[model samples]
Target: MTDQPAVPTDDPTVLTDRDLEVLAEQLGREPRGVVGIAARCVCGRPLVVRTAPRLPDGTPFPTTYYLTHPGAVAAASRLEAQGVMREMTERLGEDEELAAAYRRAHEHYLARRAELGQVEEIDGISAGGMPTRVKCIHVLMGHALAAGSGVNPLGDEALALVRDQWRPDRCSC
Candidate 1:
């Protein structure tokens, strides 16, 4: 990944100049390889960005839906600090149905990223420690926000856990 200037996009999630500016502000750097805004706050600020599978600098970016909202990022961090990932990871080992669902979620993530473009380096890999572990609530929450509820069970759970602190329905931007 190089620190190149963000590439402009014409995809369906194509961002306006204002949107790019806000994204840069939220990320504290230039938002790289962003194709579209996957999720937005109630007030219309970008909450999750749909990034290119391959970056402009020829880096394979496995994370397609990246959470950028400061409030949502902080909420996911708070959940992680509360030992939620350990509990979720433990439950994944004990629940067959949940495990299957998580695997499906992983597949869904891969499929979505495939639409952007095929990146051999990240092929078959999805972010958020999907299918086996609960590594980053930020990634899962980003997926949840981008794909909507029910597509990602763990992501949905993470979103639920942080509802009191942050929610898509509420303006936390």
Candidate 2:
């Protein structure tokens, strides 16, 4: 809704039954509120899912793009354990340019979620602690993949760090 540049969503891609099954297998449960495959690997497996703002159970789900790939999730969890989030949060405090870019990322995320459906309960709240601090690399990486490049600086950085471990070109699927 704001003046931020639009991030390309899954308007061109369609999710198949196989994709759903794979996602469900990865999650170990039925995928909920999933609208479409936001990002995929080179092997064409679903990496990120574009979910509804509110779940079917009437619960507000602010995580618009969710990372579902097992390998990527593990890498992000490893990064979290290594205190990458803490370092990123500290950097955000000292870096004006990074903070401004992160704010735009939050706005872009909100606009994308609004396109799906806005939930009043989770209004203006983007996942993984955007526009402020780094809470979850998995969420940020999901947004970075969904939004493509440059929309989220921190997310981009996190993705770059994990590139050797999980590259989009190299199929972990």
Candidate 3:
């Protein structure tokens, strides 16, 4: 990994018209239930967005922090293709310290989402297979970017693993 620290997390910021445009471009579709820009690129572009617990279409969306940057998404996908998730999940089973930390991450995610609103359908659920397995690196990366380091051990690990491919300290957008 580079000596530079990963991009620091930012508090949720009010969404602007330009932010919506950028998000749409990054996602290749209209973003749904976005409440605020949770993390940004070095150049001030949106990298992660905070979504509402319940969407307008009546869907109980569980993914609170959504990764929008195309470069970061691709990097996470590459890690998944390389079976990083499976490896991490295995490590979680063998590492008690890591498993406990991951459980805390799951609680953190739930507490944060509770502030938005309650959605019974996904009540105890956090993204990226938290507290159990590594299902989606993209979700973990997004959580790391939005929640900052140390909150999500596995998320932080995934972020570090993909540093060579994508780093929030630099803008690829």
Which lDDT tens digits does candidate 1 get at residues 26-132? 99999999989887776777888988999899989999989999999999999999999999999999999999999999999999899988988888889988879
lDDT of each: 0.86, 0.86, 0.88
Per-residue lDDT tens digits of candidate 2, residues 1-173? 12232233586348788989999998999999899988877567788899999999999999999999898898888899999999999999999998999999999999999999869999989999887999999999899888899999988898889877876656666
The 10 consecutive residues of candidate 1 with the worst lDDT sum are 1-10
Per-residue alpha-carbon lDDT of candidate 3 for residues 1-173, written as tens digits (9 for 90 to 100): 23343354435566888999999999999999999888888777788899999999999999999999999999999999999999999999999999999999999999999999899999999988998999999889889888888999988898888878888887777
Q: What is the TM-score of each candidate against the true structure?
A: 0.91, 0.92, 0.94
Instruction: In candidate 1, list every pair of residues with a backbone clash.
Output: none
Off by over 4 Å in 2: 1-9
Give the best candidate by lDDT: 3
Better of 2 and 3 by lDDT: 3
153: Cα error in model 3, Å: 0.8
Against the hidden true structure, what lDDT does model 3 obtain?
A: 0.88
How accurate locally is residue 144 in candidate 3, as Cα lDDT from 0 to 100?
A: 87
Candidate 2, residue 87: how far the Cα is off, in Å: 0.7
Model 2 compared with the native: what TM-score? 0.92
